[model samples]
Structures are given as C-alpha cells and as structure tokens.
Target: MYNVDDVVMYGTFGICKITAVEKRNFTGEEQEYFVLRHVNSDKNVFYVPTDNEAALSKLHSVCSKSDVDALISHMNSEKLIWIDNDAKRKEEYSRIIKEADYHEIIMLIKTLYLRRKELGAAGKKLRSSDENYLNLAENMLFEEFAYALDIERREVVDYIEKHIA
Candidate 1:
C-alpha cells in the first residue's frame, strides 16, 4: 500500500505520484481508490481501485539510483526468448511487457533493437505491432528511470550505452 505523495510506476503511464487515497464511486459502490497523477503531466490523472488485484499489480516501485544502476548492469544477461512466428511472438511479448518487470523490459528493448537492425539490413522494417510494443516498453522503462536517476528521459539511452558499453 502506497501513501500520499509516493511515486510509483503504473503500466504505460510510467511514473505517477499518489495524490490521495479516497473512497469514490465511479462504478457504484463507494470503494477506496488510489488517486494518482502523472509525474510529467498534470493533465493525466488516474483513480485505481484499492481492492482490484490485477489493477494494483500494475502499480510498481520506482527504483532508486543505485537500484537503477544495478538493473542496468543486469541488462546484458537479461534477454527474451525469440519466437519466430509473428503471432506467437506478439502473444508472448505482450504478456512479458504486461508483467512490468524491469529485467524483462530491458530484454524486450534489446531484442527489438536487434530485430530491427536485422530487418533493416534485409531492407525490411519492424512490424507495426512490434514497433508499438517497442515504443510502449521504452516509454515505461525510461520514465521511471529518468525520475529515479534524476536525468532527462532522452538521456536514458545514452546512459545505458555508456554503462553497458
């Protein structure tokens, strides 16, 4: 359970600050909801149910700088098992992304970069689905990384490159 002003990661919304924990009835029952606002954007606000396990599962911790560094160090070892069939790959990768694990997300980004490079060499491009997944994964990972590491989101790629190179 997070308290007010606690920053957390939520699915594709990335870094969010818990603004309040109040009982609101958007549905029908007056149930408790965690009110959150996007850290980067005031326009985006979310009210997440306190009792919904699945929704709450998407609410995750924002790593500290040291923790982020540790995760970056592990980037080399974390990798996705490549599925050759597009449909299978999409299904498997989607599940992996939705899991919201940092290690797995780093792996996903690496895998997509490699695959995109391979396809480029062959005069092809990443499928639309793959591209969308890549964008989503990058956004989620980098937002938390930027907030935690105290760096601009655009600097994340360069930071990773310097660390892992």
Candidate 2:
C-alpha cells in the first residue's frame, strides 16, 4: 500500500515513485493498479496490479544510508560459495537477481569481484555469464543506492568501497 511520492525499488527498474493509485476498468474488469514513474527516467511509467503479490513483492522500500552502512559492514564476512557447475550457477544467479535481496546482491557483487580477481591472477578472464550477472547486480545496487543517498550513480562504487571494512 504505497502512496503517491513514496519511493520504492521496483525489481530491476530500481527506484521508482508511486505517482498514482486508481481503479481502472480495463479488460472489462475494475482492478486497482499502482502507477509508478521511474525516479531517474522522465517518461517511463509502470502500471502494476495492486493485488498481484508476486509483482508487489518485487517492490521493496529503498534502503537508508544506515542500511547501506550495515550492508557494507557485513560485506567482508559474507560467504559467497561459488557453484562450479555452470547450469547450477546460472540458476542460482537468476534466483538472486529475481529475489533482489540487498544483502544477496552485495554477496553476488563481492563474489564475482573476487572471482574476477582470481581469474585475472591466473591469466584468465571472468566467464561471460558471470560478467553479465555482475553488471546487472551492480546496476541494481548502484541505482537504488544513488537514489536513496541522493548521489550520482557513478559514485556508488567508491562510496561502498569507502564503507567496506
């Protein structure tokens, strides 16, 4: 039950604002929908059904600076046990992205970062699949943090680095 102007992280779209909530009789049925506009985009609007729990669950409240600080504090100790099997790892990555849990996303980023470093040290490159998820996770995290912290998206990496123990 979000009100107008309330900011929330809407799945991969990152932070968005609830601009309106109304019942519309589309498809010959009246149902409530939350009209959302992306905080960073001027023209993107999303109409999400109010009662769709799966979709609704994707809408998470933007984390505060304190929350980000807490996440950073735990970053070093968070264990990201890598799944060596390609198929299994992909499936796990998909679940993490879909779930979009802040801590899990951080773990994904940290895991991939460490993996990339290890590969580089061994004269190898990160696998394409890993690279793709790494970028996605970073994008999701940076967008939300930037919006909540009132900073540019490019600053998130350095910001988190400063906070990480």
Model 1 residue 128 distance off true place after TM-score fit, in angstroms: 0.9
**Which residue pairs show backbone clashes in model 2?**
none
TM-score of each: 0.96, 0.93
Global CA lDDT of candidate 2, please? 0.88
lDDT tens digits, residues 51-142, model 1? 99999999987889999899998888886666789999999789978998887788888899889999999999999999898998899889
Which residue runs does candidate 1 get wrong by more than 4 Å? none
Q: Across residues 9-34, which tens digit of lDDT does each residue of candidate 2 receive?
A: 99888789999899987779999999
Q: How high is the lDDT of residue 95 in model 2?
A: 96
Residue runs of model 2 more than 4 Å from their true location after superposition: 25-28
Instruction: Report clash pairs, candidate 1.
Output: none
RMSD of each: 1.0, 1.4
Q: CA lDDT of 65 in candidate 1?
A: 95
Per-candidate clashes come to: 0, 0
